[model samples]
Target: MRIDPALRALRSNPDSQRIAQTALETCKSGWRSAEGNASIFAELIRYGRGDELGECPALSSLFADLDRAAALVEDLVSQILPQIAAHPLGQVPFRHQYSGGMAVLQLAAAGDAALSLVMYERSGDTPHSPTICFTDTERHEIALAGSGTMQIVRRNRGRRAPAELSVSSVEMKSGQNLSLCGMFETKRIESVEERLVILRLGRTGAAPEPSLEFRVADGELVHQASGDKRDSCHELMVSLLGRMGRCDAAPVLAEMTRSGSDHLRWQALRECLALDTATGFTALCGIARNPADTLSANAGSLRAQLIEAYPELAAFEKTLCLA
Candidate 1:
């Protein structure tokens, strides 16, 4: 395999190169081993009921080592990135990704512009703590070189309310990075990949520029508003809060139904239906009557899905959002 030019250059510093090689190998070994054992872990989980997981020593030990291995590799990566930035990347754009249970790295380039990512799977110490109710927080930091824009969105499809997803952004200098943080309730076991951050870079002014701008056309991934307890209401949050049986969230759901993003409006309507079918279906009928391009399309798809799932919801499809 042809070594990355940047990696080849990194090799110049003997000690730094050694650290990078060792970290990469260790991370790879642990991730592969975890993947191999995943099926066995899942099987063991199904063996019994409440105490089966905590009772298994193998499961507990494996989770502990995976957490340790990821932290070690993450530290090594932190050490290497600063060195790479000290020396400017070459004009050649490249993309490299390394995925493990606890972390994943994505690097892509287009001539003068490049995007590199280090995603960590936020892990908890007690994988056996499903017995108790608790909350966990997550945060992300992104570094960009040259010029670009970034969008950070948080979506919750679980029982807890969505924390109003912040539309905050930051400008980056050649060596600077941006960090954003927020907290969410962790009442249930959520997918490790739930947190998403998309980084977009300005075109490098090269001919036939790559589509460097980030896009999220798929509306189905819509998350409820961020229910940060203290943050301002985000429209999506209305539905999830309602799901928790908070009647005070009803008016919030009403406001969310009028959002410009039809994707959001539709989801809000779904929440309304669960809360008060008459009013929610009424809003749905109104939206369907006058649909736009992307938003309307999302509304229609969701309408079909809901109707299919609950045949009675079919009555509301034509009368609700799409009309």
Candidate 2:
């Protein structure tokens, strides 16, 4: 493999201590150049052993320097490995390629114990191919680099609400790829609901992103709203009901019509007529047949408009019509 100028400079340095210090600092800073760091470490090990470079006073110092650099690298890995292993997105094997090389790491959590990690490395211009691994007797495959994006998907099977399960996606850094995606379901479950959370971390210049979804039975979709405000889901549902008659959203319209709130009842009445003729007509019949019920004035006006627009509502209008 060809060495970059930065790697070449670190390899040729006469002072091993300075070279090792720089390597430690780069790793500490979470450097974007993984290939460069790996190359420098490989060279440092070769020189420290006095195999690649002739013996000299610097060789003894090089050994100590290399040791310190290796320790730092191990420390950095130790701290990050646990977090990656526990991450829902990190549970899968992932691989990515950049201009120089690629890395593949498989992650798994061992019951309450430490995480299990298996890492692979390769260098070249071509992308890495997909690989497979097993966890809890199940097998999964990781995608080839530059194929499509990888995501973590969670499915709930128990009698709990759909919102109880969570799913998410994470993006790998350039030259870094995801090698596997796995599915995990807990056996020792809890009663509290769960939501899908996706965590994405990119290269140093790239921003981290996350997406969440809450699903309920009967095709109810609740999207998270922007800002720190609480109750966004309920707020969004209310806003959607307000603009009903304009869109063909039958589920939410049905929900609004069944709502006990008078405001929601009025909104649903206006939107239902534009949704579907059969369903809208049936809803109007229910209101006309129960004119004594406390429906808002707006709801009543909408009923009147339905009669005027569709003469079919004329018979029920007599029963609901008030002087």
Candidate 3:
């Protein structure tokens, strides 16, 4: 393939290289000293309160300051687009290419709050995503250019509320802003008019509840993921200990089964069972017998399956019954 003479010169010439490098560095420097970014960073640290806090109260303030964040994004884009036009190799730093033909340019992040500019291209003939996912953080989005249609859904509540979700369609026009709670609401881009650019500000801190993914048609829970970094790490450790056959860790796992989220408790119980059946069986039986335990029904079902698979477990079942 033959390369264009100008493009080749831009790639090889020392003068062109210096100009491209200077353009990229200028974008980064301009963003660091942006007017509103320092205040946003200060707010993130103040309201983040470490990861131990369940929810971020800083989200409310971030949503209210959407225009300030928009101004920062506008300033950053003004510095970046010109350089890209001058040289194809010149681009902003911290640009992340994600799935669905979308790109995210992280402008600034501190503590639990992050500001990003997202660019979405119209996916011609691409089918809509069958699933929608939500995390524990809260977010605010401002459309800087182009337009799109968004589908939003939230949990229905009240004494007589039905099991179905309350769904709504939102027109995401240029200059519009939206605030959403991942704990209670989720939004999906249904269609883009052309190319869409948005300024998104969010609290990256995890809430008490885990992230969830659900099927749009039936609202079936397809996946659950822990938002807490420590919980995820603990889960990995538990799996490792179980695979290593560390029966000495059974006591620690036993204690873990009594605390934390329902999912974590169940995970600890499972790893404990794999390492030591006797201890695990006793804990399992205790959970199954407790009507107050959230995992009681699941534990009871597992206990039945175990007894059927191993006749020796029947003796343990009989002993528990007698006790």
Best by lDDT: 3
Model 1: per-residue Cα lDDT over 85-106, one tens digit each: 5434422122445444223343
Name the Cα RMSD for model 3. Answer: 5.7
Q: How do the residues 244-274 of candidate 2 rate in per-residue lDDT, one tens digit apiece?
A: 5445565566565655444445455556666
lDDT of 3 by residue, 1-323 (tens): 99998778876786877788787887777666666555555555655555421344443444445565466666766777777777677655675767776888777676676777888888887786777777777778878778888888785433232225567899887778888887678787778888888878777554456887767777777787888778888899999998999999988888898878787789999999999898888888889989999899999999999988987988987898898
**Model 3 regions lying over 4 Å from their true place:** 1-30, 50-67, 78-95, 158-162, 204-206, 227-229, 289-292, 304-323
Query: Candidate 3, residue 252: CA error in Å?
Result: 3.1
Ten-residue stretch with the least lDDT total in model 2: 196-205
The candidate, 2 or 3, that scores higher on lDDT is 3
Q: For residue 277, what is the lDDT in candidate 2?
A: 55
lDDT of 1: 0.42
RMSD of each: 20.0, 22.0, 5.7
